[model samples]
Target: MIVSEGQLIQSGDPLLKVDFKNVKDNVPSIVTPIVFTSLIGREVTLEKSGFQRAGSNNMISIKK
Candidate 1:
């Protein structure tokens, strides 16, 4: 899904594709309770943020 039929992709172009088969459909909901319990009370702060450029596009980068 990263590139369209006629689209171009270059080096470092971020491409992520996820396939959801029936076997994997319930994974998130099953794991959410266990994961959320540890994060019930917490403070998260984003410390650094910037953009990385490739070709004519700028992609945002964030760090904790």
Candidate 2:
């Protein structure tokens, strides 16, 4: 799962951001056979990073 409570992540940034098209449209981009995230155990500092939020996103569901 995406870790949104680290040292770098913010409120509106891409916490669990993922696109299915990246798997379907460009299969070659995925070096692995699974849909697991490879960003774990890494340090990311977004203090000076310039990124844009996606315009539209699918409805999200949070299970407690």
Candidate 3:
């Protein structure tokens, strides 16, 4: 979500992305909670403007 079609999102960036389809309006509570756990204690940077590929991430790598 951070890096869209032409934005530059390089490796080693501290970020995470999710792709949700067919959201039934009652699943955010169930699905988002666990997904956010991975981001706990991490820093997030929001772009005021950018375009990135629209889809869910295929893999996530965390460094301890």
User: Top TM-score: which candidate number?
Assistant: 1
- lDDT by residue (1-64, candidate 2, tens digit) is 4664445764466555567676768675634332324556654433322333555342232222
lDDT per model vs. reference: 0.45, 0.47, 0.47
What are the per-residue Cα lDDT tens digits for candidate 1 across 1-64?
Answer: 7767656777577655555465377575422111222343564443333433335333322233
TM-score for each of the candidates? 0.24, 0.21, 0.20
Q: Between which residue pairs do clashes occur in model 2?
A: none
Identify the superior model by TM-score, candidate 1 or candidate 2. Answer: 1
> Worst lDDT window (10 residues) for model 2?
55-64
Task: Give stretches of model 3 more than 4 Å off.
Answer: 14-16, 19-64
Alpha-carbon RMSD to native, per candidate: 13.4, 13.3, 11.7
Worst 10 residues of 1 by lDDT: 29-38
- Candidate 2 runs further than 4 Å off: 1-5, 14-27, 30-53
For candidate 2, what is the lDDT?
Answer: 0.47
Candidate 1 achieves a global lDDT of 0.45
